[model samples]
Target: MTAKQRVIRVSTEQPTYAVTVLGTEISIDVNGFIPRGATSFDVRGTSGLRVYVIYNPKLVTKPIGAVRWPLNSEVEVIVASNDPSSVVNDNKVRVSYYGPTGETLIANAWLYLTCMAISLDADTSRTGVVESTANNKTKWTWGPHGEGAILLVNCDRDGPSSGNLDNAYPSVRSYEDLQDMSLMILSTQGPAGVFDSHKLLLHISMFDAGKVRVFHVNGNTSLSSYEHVLGSDKLSYAVKRSDGKARHSFFVEGLAFPDADFAGLVSLNATLLEQPSQDLPATPVFTDTVVFRVAPWLMTPNTLKPVEMFVCSIVRGQNTNQKFLEAIKILAKEANCKLTICPEVENRGDRWIQDEMEFGYVEAPHKSFPVVFDSPRNRGLKEFPFKMILGPDFGYVTREPKNGRISSLDSFGNLDISPPVTVKGKEYPLGRILIGSSFPGSGTRRMAKVVRDFLYAQKVQSPVELYSDWLTVGHVDEFLTFVPAPDRKGFRLLLASPLACLKLFKEKQKEGYGGAALFEGLGRVGRITLDEILADEYLRSDSRYVQSCIDWNRNILKRELGLSERDIVDIPQLFTLEHSSATALFPDMVNMLVLGKRLGIPKPFGPIIHGRCCLEEEVCRLLEPLGLTCTFIDDFFSYHVLSGEVHCGTNVCREPFSFHWWNILP
Candidate 1:
């Protein structure tokens, strides 16, 4: 019989037998050897050993001491030892059977035992909860009962000299890169000679070997002491105990993300192998497994604090935004945020920086960093994210369509996220992702399938699609945005409302401002009075249709983000239909740059009433109550005339959420 067998059979003919007991339970079968007509039995063992006689397995509770063994039951044995056995078979357990008469002895058997302790552990309990004992370490689940270690993708560039993500290269570049990996420990305690005769192999499945890499940390604090042990090229590694230390630690780093074909969960095992003879093959005596789930990429919302702002400089073309750039520089200083200006030579006249990429992040218990998600628009600013933004501690990831087909809807401006919310008693701690697409079943225009699949696979922020194909540019930012608020959900959903603008104009006409002209003091554009604007029947009908489109998305936001009417702020705006698609009648006010308490809005140049532009006055009145400052910026000729506005021309990288993504129940 091998030492790995759980059941030890004993008879009167063979009473003495040696068995190696690890940190697991062993059952001793005494059914065949016990005499007939015996009513009960007694089990006795050494001080460090625990012995239990189970009469009825169904009724078995945690026995306090040696219990009576009736017919058709078994004996369970456990050995607890802090040190290894100094002598061979030093521990013993005896089982005595008695007949119906209490004084009569029927039969008895003795079992000799040798104990050893071995375990492999990781953060398999609560995130910060660590323990050395081997309990629930193999299986991994989700929710409140979830238990497993979390692994980061290690996609950040930790070494400035390396010019690539740390995961791309197998060799360690710096100590900071090592900090991004998860920790695993192997512990063994027993007679040294037993380990010499046995082999300990650290192995991973061929499927998982490519997903993770393990490194052995020798008993020193130097770069050369770390050795790469197992990864894509190697499936199993023989663990060396030459240092004579009872404990060893290994660092594990994830190389790939959880894609469509991969489930994100990986397991590694440490097995103790034993060879019975020279001619026999080695067999596994005990195996301890620890599981890890790769972390997902997450998006940040505008409500978060802005760490940096990105804008492109245009100085060559007739559509140069020199004045808008100056305005943004002052706003950046007011917000105390760092400003990064992409020169004209690098941008190649593509001023739409916001459409090129979106800022997000990836996190693990060990390390976290901001990751820029490049869109597949492939415009003039396509290389900006990878060449300029990706550097030390910054990551870059992108998804391109297989057929190389893309539309204006693939731009990053069509992407957005809401602040955290609770819907129908379910809390989305990371909020929800919002994407713009055609109406259901329209199948006209949509974001690329590869990009959508990648966002859905994140599992934290469940994405909600809204209809934006009605717009010529086809971006969600043109009609909707979010701003920080002092009350009510910690933020407010800002939606462009053509109906609100029409009502404001009619109220102005009633108050004897009917002759107030829009585009005042502007030479390039013609001035139109409020009375004339209200008289245009086609314009009124187009504004009604635009209201319906905004209303559709408003209702969706209410349901998906658990928002109400009070949580939404409507900004006065109008749209004119051209070729059956809507375009902003004036500079779109909702498409504005949000910097903490300050907002840089596109000046609508609406009719001036009593020495104040009614459009600017209306926006200030709605937002100022929530402790916000609005600055009207003139992007009329440079941006608005070109079919974009303030938000489309700029991008912001905000701080990540305080809550860890791993804690979410996905």
Candidate 2:
């Protein structure tokens, strides 16, 4: 692409000269340089320079070596220099006017030219490769073939004494915070006086000013040396060049994510402004632009290694979750993961920690960190993520519905992500995001549009909506989860199969254990025998309906995640209808906490046959060969009876995928 030309009107009445950039063109007024009575004119320039006299409407015509102008046609004069001037006024273009003879010079005008080189560059290649010669940096593209610079949301707090995210405050708090931003280099090479006469301005559009901030680094080692140059209310900054360096580097940090209105693409430009006179305003002589697309927030699947675990503990009550917390503590210790327990005073009886928030992360070529996305449920744990999790390298983000309306499907439990997979020939290295919504055209409960739009805007983890409105809690975790595997796509999708549970029960009845009762030791709940469970027609009908609902999503997962039957594990589970929505009949086994090779599952007190619970044994047989440990925690009283299970009461923050998101084709 050609650089925009700076139009300059040359006057013969005064000493005419102009300083310009090498690659940029200057439009000159030919008639203004003509003398009062001259009828003909000739234009010439230095040896290596070209002066274009455009006669045709289209500027595609070739340049002529000689030019003699009389009155043949209207013309436009353009001056271009391919190389920078070694010294000021060394290259000159002159226009001489003559009588009708065309040989006798009546008057002459001289325009002395000095050229310089200036450019602003970043990782415009979109491959995380920075090239100083990169051009066309103003536009951005998407997909594997896309090209544009990438900027990270400086949402992590790098300073130990900071009270908020690094992006929340404009000033750089520490040297570490600068590492998370993208680097932009401004290079200027010319005579020293040219810079003094012209002003270098760094500017951003007012609309994008709040989305990003630019900082000029004066020193390498100290936080005090970083200067906040452009952001927020500041649209433009006059860059000082007192030190006279050839190259100046500025760090660009993203402050917000791509949402409903923002496309995530932002541009910053360095402009060289020249003042024609003290009385006239400054005009831009040249400009170099660079675009950056902010990194999207990405989710971490259970297949990834767990780095930290969050759970809520109830101090006093019959429904206290102390036992559940203890079990998680042991599991966390075994998994070598950090554990955080939110006390009852903070959670206020809300034990569904998983529903409150989801842990994900944002990444750039320079840095990355975990960011917790808080659900708009505004429940007891609403303040938990912001007040506790958002600190010292951790980030927080949330989206609330504009209509002030939200459903159970809006909970984070309805928000899950698949392990990395390639469907057909397309690769999803960051995996696909799974969100619960009503079936198409059903007009039933669905996730809010605002939240859905936010997730979809992320681009990388293309979201897949599943049919989850059939459940009472309306959460995908009530029926499906993923666990790490030693082979076959590195993970196994565990789905709650009512058909599998019925088959197991029928097999046990045939084995002459029909009289064995479920919930054998629980006092608060009544027991039901295997024979009685199989005999209830309404229960059977409900199980079939629930199975069909799960099967609908099962097919979607198969197609979207590129999974075969071997990639899925069917855990024994049954659902019963309540108020036209399905709820777990016993503790849900599929809603388990996954920590690498270990899993904390809810104790489904199935009928004990041959000295063991068949439910537990069946789960072990299905998963043990794949190197997964199953420890059933008793969540029956604390969570199961309350319409939740192990996974609902706890949330896990896992390590980010090793593959950079920018490497993926969305």
lDDT of 1 by residue, 1-666 (tens): 112245666665556554353556666777767667676666788766756543445665443454555545444443333345655466788878777754577777788766656677877765543467636777777666667788888877777743777888777778988878888888876555565456788999999999999988886968677788989998999887542337888888888776666778999999888764668888776788898888888899888999999999999878899999999999999999999999987788899999999999888766788989999998889888887888777888899999999999999999999989899888888889999999777648899998988888888898999999989999999999999998878999999999999999999999999999889988988999999999999999999999998999999999999999999999999999999999999999999999999999999999998899999999999999999999999999889999999999999999999987766776
**What is the alpha-carbon lDDT for the whole of candidate 2?**
0.86
What lDDT does candidate 1 reach at residue 218? Answer: 82
Candidate 1 global TM-score: 0.89
Tell me the whole-model lDDT of each prediction, alpha carbons only: 0.83, 0.86
Q: Per-residue lDDT for 1-666 in model 2, tens only? A: 346477776666765778888677887776765676787667788975778676764533333553456633466677888777777777788877777766678877788887877788898775455677776688877655667789988877777643777888878887778778898988877676676567889999999999999988886747777788999989999877643237788889998899889989898999989875678889887888888999999999999999999999887778888888889999999999999888888988889999999999988766688999999999888788888888767888999987889999999999999999999999999999999998778747988898999999998999999999999999999999999898979999999999999999999999999999899989878999999999999999999999999999999999999999999999989999999899999999999999999999999999998889999999999999999999999999999999999999999999999987766767
Specify the highest-lDDT model's number. 2
| Regions of model 1 farther than 4 Å from truth | 1-5, 8-22, 30-44, 57-90, 93-112, 125-130, 139-146, 242-245
* Alpha-carbon RMSD, each predicted model: 3.9, 3.5
Clash numbers, per candidate: 0, 0
